[model samples]
Target: MGICDAPARAKVLNMSQHNGSFGCNYCKIYAPFNEDLKCRVFVPTSNLQPRTTDEWKKLALAASNTKITRANEREFLGVKGWNQLLRLPYIDIVSFCPPDYMHSQLLGTVRLLLAYWLGGRSQLFKYNFHMVWHLPQVVRQYGPLITNSAFQLENWMGKIAKQIHESKIHIAEQAINKCSVISSTITNFYSNIDCFETEFIKYF
Candidate 1:
């Protein structure tokens, strides 16, 4: 049920970011960076198996236990380390989360296609038009994305941004910590609502 952009998804899952090898969450797809294209290109493969939550935990644990640096990396099965979310048994740490449509589709594919078509690169982009090609499959897997897209959640960013001081040191950390505190406070208040009502009755 986590709806987030690519970077946030990587942070929450403690996995490789979108640009890294084996960065995909749904499948074990290795996307290597194409220097000429200036982006990671996913080589289509049919035999790759979809990632499972159990497998994700195992891989994450194995990656964390090792003294793996750059040279000895086994791609870590796309997992860098364990996340707090993994500790929750009811949560599906893999497959349940899908990439945000706003970032992945509107900002990414649409912008790219627009740039190509409007910027007079349409002929050149014909060979590089795989972005739109995957839409149907993505829709099939995740359902109609407009409902769960990041559009609604992103509205809070403007308000949260205004809270930051001019110093701007650790801005993201400050925002996240503030959100966590707010969430904890709300949960605590609701959990103790009956006590509050009793105290209110006595006061009146």
Candidate 2:
């Protein structure tokens, strides 16, 4: 197979540098696995059993009406239902989503999620962005927690953000190299469908 058109298991094992426009360590493991041809696997459900008639009726009623909010956390479980409804027939939302919004939101989400999964916020890893983009917006959306981070503590960070704002091609490169929070943010981003989309889907 051609580059990035191989098996997931094999791609991950390669661990060598990826020859691409952007140098991503994770892509060395993931890019090749994504041939952009194979379909996503359907998830098996509840021992592959059917819901009883009343269960189906209850679900139908639940689906027709509801607005989700943080106050009504349980209702937002609807994201799983949305995922189930859309998983088939191809659900690649990447191209459909807004590039600027995604660019601004994705990096932060990925790092936050990783921090929670690996252990906690303190256990983040270092990454290397091309330069940076809408970090102020990300910090605003995620809360003030990032304000206390070592990555944001540098005196020159304001200048870096200015650079990102002025030159869209560049990004917050050094933040990832020295800060573990960036990695944690990445993992956190992919963990929850609802939380992620709710916080930043307008960009998409």
Question: What TM-score does each of the candidates earn?
Answer: 0.66, 0.17
Question: RMSD of candidate 1 to the true fold?
Answer: 10.5
lDDT of 2 by residue, 1-204 (tens): 011211221232221222222123211111122234332222222232222323323433564465544455233222212223223344222111111222222444466566677887432211222112223433454323232233322323444344344344334554544345544453443344345445564654
The per-model lDDT (C-alpha) reads 0.66, 0.31
What lDDT score goes with residue 34 in model 1?
70
Question: Which ranges of candidate 2 are over 4 A from the true structure?
Answer: 1-64, 78-204
Best candidate, lDDT? 1
The ten-residue window of minimal lDDT in model 1 covers 122-131
